[model samples]
Target: MKILILKRDKLGDMLLTTPMFALLRQHFPGARIDVLANTYNAWVIDGNTDVSRVWSYQRVKEGGRIHWRAAFAQLRQTLALRAEEYDWIIVANGDASHRAIKRAAWLGGCNLVSYTDAKNSHRKVNHPLEIPRQIHEARRMANLLTPLGISLPEVLPPLRFQLPAEAQTFANQWLAEQGLTPGSYITLGLGARRAKKQPTTEQIIRWTRHFHEAWGLKTVFMWTPGKSDNPMYPGDDETAQPVLDAKLPWLVPFRGPLKPALGLIFNGRTSLFPDSGLMHFAAASPGGVLGFFAETDVSPAPAQWGPVGPRARWLEAPKAVSQLEDASVFAELESLLK
Candidate 1:
């Protein structure tokens, strides 16, 4: 049997789809399971044990005008995907838009599965899975498989990713050079695509001081690679400069690919994040996490996208990021670390 999952979304969405991959593996251990995701987020599934392979494509920004060359590239990739002749193609977490559904069906599959709300006419999918809009995104995705007679697990599994032994060893050696080791340091995942949702700059410094002074754990500041001229990937180097310049001997900066970074988290004590892909990475790691979430109209709420793990906990802002009190968040972190 062959199955393909279309999760052409960003990092957080792809991480939430991990449970669906787990379910597919449990139900059809012999089947080959593949995923189609955005190039930037394809790493989320790179080391997934349940997924057989990951196919990637660049994501065109929504509402941004696409040039003819970019459009042609997407078309060529879609045609190549259609040649795979998959037995089942599941469009996980896509809406009922004509463009999205059409692409899912266009991939040349015997059966196409996806979800729809009551308002949708159900014209886009061969297997239309109806579900509520407000539930946790992971559970909502898992429930889509019920029509196939796959009994739901009583408890949803945690998000997951795997790292090679070499990667772990490299991380350990690097930590040793820095006078650190597993379970002795914490990572602060700074920078989100959406900057408004993050705590104020002042708040981060205060929080770092509190963590260092109270928990007695060294801190690693993490950020994505970015250019100074481009706004698209404004790396947190500028944001992290103050803490770096403070000459606080306990802080270190990490900037690199997701795999080794996951390795670092895998060997670490705990982490704090402001609703970024790093939160998902930490949740997948065998470590603890404290994720701060602020209300946003543009994206899903924290209840729907917060970290999921036995040791993972999240704090929802009382109102907005500007109004969030750093003291309250530190209090929550104190409890989690203890």
Candidate 2:
């Protein structure tokens, strides 16, 4: 069967959806599974084993979000997707990706698309996230296709991607050029979809340099577009923007493709990121590690959002072991050095 999984979100969001790719492969065995994502999130699946193809959509400005241009692109993609005669199209987004699916179906001539009718957009779609049983977003996606008489073993599937041998070699060469080694390095995610979701800029600087000095961990800072310039994605709409928008101006303006941000999470020794998509990617990578904090907690104290499985040790704190106190994080990072 031909399958299309649609996920139009940030990098980490796409990464989480990837685990479902593994599950789909196991259940269908011979299905031709493909994914549709925003341009920024497209590369996350570049070397993924389970997915057979990728389709990318442009991230448009809020003013012209679903304008004629977007409509034309959607129409074209949907028409192409229609040619595939997908036996199933699982939209991996909650309400957010549903919009894309609706457009695609309108354009593609396939009306039977599935996605999490998530709380975030339930009112719009008016469809409850039924099959997935309304659990984690990842689980919900897996649930969507389960109705098609597919089920995998009870064990959770993993998200994975292989660096092209040359890419791996190039990455190693890049590391060597920086005089860095994997164990002796710490990577910091300096950008987020929401600026308030991040630890302060001063915190990032202190944490990275501190770890470098105390643990001898070389540093890598993930950068996004116009971050130093505008520092925030021009939000949903100025009037509809979250009020905290005024408080967070130092973050990345994030108008470029999100691929670079997703790419940033893979190499870190431990990530200090909020509960966003990159955190999921870092947690899911072959041997990835992260320090995750909950975005649910909006306090000034940084939260640690780490890998949830054997590959990570999730750290949650009002204890203040932050990306700011780099020296302290360096000490904690020692355990992962080997």
Candidate 3:
């Protein structure tokens, strides 16, 4: 049997659906399990034993109807996917993967299912079952298998990852070259796709300085390719009016490690970021993580199937969900570090 899971979204969201890949493997055992993700998330699927292949697709939106370009891409992908003779395909991303769903069904199709909430998305197919939006997405993803006779495992499944052999070596050498030794170093992940979720430049600087001074750990500013340098943290009139012009290193350029950089911090290398793949990578690894997720109400915990382990401490604001206060964030971080 062959299976494919399609979920197209942000890095953090992809991190959530990984557990379902494992569940499929457990239920089916001998089948080829795969994930059809986006270009931005193909790397997360690497080092996974459960999945056989990772396919990437761009968001196909046009005319408020699936665009012709996107449709062509889907036709090519689905037609090729049909050749694999898959027995099942799980569209975990959203109702948007409906194109894949229909195409897969038309060409030597398979058992088709998708994860969607009637409250948030329209019912585009026959598989979606309504579930709580914030009820630990990983759990919900795995639960999707229960009705299908896939027995639930006893152990708390984790979103798994196998650190690339080369990356592990690179990380070791990277840290050594930076004069960074093992122990409890803090990865000050301070990048976010939106300004609202990210702290103001001044806030980030103050947070980094405080963590370094208090913990004696090095600060790592998480960076993403093509993401413009964030010189300012988010501020608005209706919300917390950020105190700026504090002469801080808030707008500091990313002068640290390189992408796929070989570096680790205090025996407990950690990362702090506003919902990005780097942060997820840290979470996916055994390393510690302090994740600040705003905008959405998703959980920080990695999928319960992957090799990468648990999220040490996840801090998010309540309601409208972004814009964390310094004092409150510190209190939370203090607890986690201990």
CA-lDDT, candidates in order: 0.74, 0.55, 0.57
**Model 3 CA lDDT for position 105:** 49
Top candidate (lDDT): 1
Model 1 over residues 28-59: C-alpha lDDT tens digits?
Answer: 99999998877777876777999998887765
Better of 2 and 3 by TM-score: 3
Best by TM-score: 1
Off by over 4 Å in 2: 57-73, 96-98, 107-128, 131-134, 152-154, 164-174, 193-197, 200-214, 223-268, 294-309, 317-335
Candidate with the larger lDDT of 2 and 3: 3
Q: What is the lDDT of candidate 3?
A: 0.57
Error of 3 at 108 (Å): 3.4
Best of the two (1, 3) by TM-score: 1
Those runs of model 1 whose alpha carbons end farther than 4 Å from true positions after fitting are 56-85, 116-124, 164-170, 227-231, 297-299, 321-327
Clashing pairs in 1: none
